[model samples]
Structures are given as C-alpha cells and as structure tokens.
Target: MRTILILSMLFCSIGPANAAKTKKPKSEEQKTLYAIGADIAEQIINQFLFEEKERPYVMKGFQDRLAEGKLDIEVKDYRGKIRQMIVDRQQALRNKFLDEATAREGAKRFPTGLIFTETLKGTGEKPTLKDKVRVHYHGTLTNGQVFDSSVARNAPAEFRVDGVIACWKQGIPLMAVGGKAELICPSGIAYGKAGRPGKIPPYATLVFQVELLAIIK
Candidate 1:
C-alpha cells in the first residue's frame, strides 16, 4: 500500500502531461510547482550519487524493484540496509587511501592519527592551540576532489587552531609561521561520520596542503 501511494504521488506530480508541455510558457503557479519538483529531483539525485560510486547500478536496481512490485520489505529496513552499504564502502576507501598516504617517505604519523609532512621549514614561533593564525590551504578528499581552498580564493584564512577539526588542532602546532606542510587526516580527526553536507561526504578522509603565514599573536 505504501509503495502504491508513493508511486501514485510521483505520477500525479510529474507524469506524461507535464513532460509533453515542456516547450510551452507556464503560468506563475505552474512555474512554482515545476521549480519545486526540479528541486526535489536534484536533491534525490545528489543523495544517491554522493557516496554510491555505482549510483547508476543502484538506481537501476531500485527501478526494477519498483516496476516488479517487490515492496515486501519495510521502507525503514530498506533504507537502513542501503545506509550500511554506503558506510562499508566509505570505510574501505578511507582505509585504502590512508595506507597509501602513510607509506610515503617523509610522512610522519602522530599518536592521534594525524599524519603530516613538512614541505618547507620555518624559523618563526609556532602558535598554540588557543592562538589565532593565518594560513593558506587547499583541502581535498582522499580521492583528490578538492572541497575547499583558501589559495583559490586568493586569501589566507584566519582562525584559532582549536576551533578547527581535531586534526588541525594537533597538526598545525607542529609548523612555525611561514612553514608549509601536507596533512593527511583520518575521518575520526576530520569530519567523522557526519561530514559537511553537499561539500564533504560522511566518513571521508581529508588531505590538505597548508602554509602558515602568521601566529596572529
């Protein structure tokens, strides 16, 4: 019954009638409804594609199940299973990347699971966790997708060391002003299980090329 209701709602909201009139100019009410439908569709696509590398296959499986009327499983149980699969895949990728990063020469691992390599040595004082500092950074996922970069913005970022992720709090103190380093962070020390939505995925390991500019007193 639930499956039927969901299918009915989907069909009523976005069916052949709507698709057939795509080239025509819509009234304000029709435009508003169309925007809402598009937004919902985009969110669903992004959620499925975010952690599922084989999203096309997953979507195909979903469509087949829906078409065949195989809705015996409860919705909550199905969602739980999918979530577990995504978590397992994420952990596998994170471990593989960490292994490769740690095997590199010149890389040093801290007891807290933060790994770093100094690219440029500095002679100035190092900032404490409580002290605010300015730095330029390029941050990426283990898969090399850059999620954030102060260098790209042509500006240095300033914040207290303790205010950032656990990895930054522990790794930044190892560098003095003007020093540059690359930090490889474990998920526990980075965003952990709940990453920044739409930017970083859950259980993601992060890599950062950071240049310390000032201790900011």
Candidate 2:
C-alpha cells in the first residue's frame, strides 16, 4: 500500500516538472539568468579557441559554482601565468615565420631587419624619405591572411615616405617607380607588440607586396 502511494506521488511530481522544462523562461529573473548564460557562452567559448572535449569540463566548473556557490579554482591565482603563456607562444610563432622568410631566394636583410625580395625590377627613380609617393600594396600576415589591400579597391594610396610604418619608410626607398617587391616586416618595425586591435594581433610579422607607381613631387 505504501509503495503504491509513493509511486503515485513520484509520477505526479515528474509530470509537471517535465512539462515546465519544455516551456521557455518566463519570469524576469529567469530571463536575466538565461541571457547571462548566453552572453558568457558566446564571449568565452566563441572568442577563444577551445577544444570540443574541453567543453564538458568547462560546464562542470560552471555548474559547481552555481550549485556550491564557490569556484573550483580561483581565477586570480593563474590569470597572470596563463596570460604570459599566450604571449610567449605568439612571440615564438612570429620569430619562426620571420626566420623562414629571411631564407627565401633573393631575400635581403636590410639594416633595419626588413626582408626585401624584388619580384619586378623598376626602371624609374626611387622615392626619397621626404617625397610623397603613390603606390598599390597588398598586405598579409605570415599565414597568408590578407589584412589590407589598396590594390583590391583599385585605388592607389599616396603618403609621404616618412609618414608610414617603419618598414614602409625604409622599404619604399628601395623600390623604383615601376618596381614590385615583397617586404617582410618584423613586429618591431611594423605595428610593434600592440598591433592594430581588430585588423592584426600582437607580435605579428607582416608581408606586403608593394608596387611603386610614382614619387609624387
């Protein structure tokens, strides 16, 4: 008689709970909690590269914190060390890319550590530091991701030779008016440790295929 009464209570409790689970969050507090969950998932998971297998562990930590009201590990203890690891990894990658680029045929390492490889010899005059120049350039990262290209827009860029990045300031002088050359710029002479936030990353090595159109006087 007791077992039958217990079974009846179990089914009654399960039925409404299962029905409630099927409906979306309706209360303001429930909606806010859901929104916070969605935002955290997007920012942490999508913004960083996490392995598929690591997701369950991540959720476990999240669940523990919600249920136990405490973190499995303190973030302050490992945050600095973790940040340094990422920085060191990025530095090593950039160094390896620059080393291989320097070994390419016709590659010349100038005094500023810029690697210049001429693809087409120019017949006209080269631009001076003070000269305003017009040129088309296709810029990419070491991984062949195109970051910017005036050539793609079919509009040539005009700027003073001394006004651009250190790599361009030194590189433009090496190209004659009609010449095309590849400029491999290390981070120190390019955007440096803090690169363009959206367009580039820290410690990136840039490759620019630059064609000198004219030295605008």
Candidate 3:
C-alpha cells in the first residue's frame, strides 16, 4: 500500500514535467519555423523599406501621416491572402503581356492577328494624326475585367487617334474606314506611368477590341 502511494505520487509529480518536456520539442520546432518565416518576412520588408527610403517625398508623406497620428489600423488575419491578392493582381497584369507577345508571335506566322481569324491586308488607309474617327471599342484589363466599352453602351467614341494615348496613335493607323481589330497596348503606350485614378492605376496597360465603324470627316 505504501509502495503504491509512493508510485502514484511519483507518477503524478513527473506527469507535468514529462508533458512540459514533450512540449519543448514542439515549441522548438515551432520557434525554428517562426524564425525562418520572420527572416523571410524581414528580407521582404527590408527591401520594401529600402525602396521607400529612395523616395524622399513618399517617406516624408508617411512621416507626416504618422505624426498626424491617424493610424488606427486594425489587424487583419489572413495577411498571406492579402499579399497573394496583390501578387496575383500584378502577375495577372504581367501575364497579359506574355500572352499577348505569344499571340503576336503566333499571329505573325499566321495571316492576321484578328480574333475573327480573317486575313486583313490593313487597307493601309492609315488615318492622319489629327483625324477624328468614330469607333466602337471594348476595353479590358489583363485580368479580364472590362473597364469600358463604347459598343456595350451602344455609343461610338470620337477619338483623334494621335492626340489620345500612343496606342491609338499606332493602332488606329492599322484600321481602315470600316474595320475591326484587337489592339494590345502596353503600359508605355497606353496609360504610361501616370494612370487615370478611380478607373486606372499606374503602369496599367489595356487590351482593346475595337471596331472602326466610320471615320467622321
């Protein structure tokens, strides 16, 4: 009976110690993973901070905002998902250029780059720089988001091709008086670095499936 009591107490006293010992391995593993993750996170954050530091105006803006003490930021769970959303959006935009380039390569080998798959010898009418042309067009972001469409709204847009974005300057010349074509415009040609707010952001390219309904003289 005394032996049983001593054994029971011994087991009871060691139980917590053993459980705690078991937890150390798991905690150590977790800590190692966390350290690795933190190192990776720090590297990314450091790179971003370095870039931000290069822009004194932006750094000043952040400092000004911080001084104003307007930071009531809430913690969001799913931070990885938020980061992934941004990365995916960027990749979505990038992939459009890749896809367009691939398509253009394939297209040059073919008769026409038209989605209609019809051979267009480009009537070579080549409208003037100041020419006001009426066209129906569908504009989409690389990620398949339709931003605008004169065709969808049942109205044709009046555009002086050259006066507008460079895409129009280059693309409209490829169209005849009545012709349909798709124009994949890179950011350099379309919106450039300064993009229209609310509708478009910086470094945004556009893909326009446009139909030249007429050239209004």
Top-lDDT structure, candidate number: 2
Model 3, position 198, has a per-residue lDDT of 74
Candidate 1 lDDT tens digits, 86-111 = 56655766677777878898899878
Of candidate 1, the 10-residue stretch with the lowest lDDT total is 1-10
Off by over 4 Å in 3: 1-96, 99-101, 104-124
| Model 3 lDDT at residue 117 | 18
Give the winner by TM-score.
2
CA displacement after TM-score superposition, residue 164 of candidate 3 (Å): 0.9
Q: Give all TM-scores, in the order shown.
A: 0.67, 0.67, 0.50
Question: What TM-score would candidate 2 get against the native?
Answer: 0.67
User: lDDT of all predictions, in order shown?
Assistant: 0.78, 0.79, 0.59
Q: Model 3: C-alpha RMSD to truth?
A: 18.8
lDDT of the structure predicted as candidate 1: 0.78
Sorting all predicted structures by lDDT, with the top scorer first, yields 2, 1, 3
Can you write out model 3's per-residue Cα lDDT over 35-74, one digit (the tens) per residue? 6545654543422333445556433434444456654343
Q: Which of 2 and 3 is ahead in TM-score?
A: 2
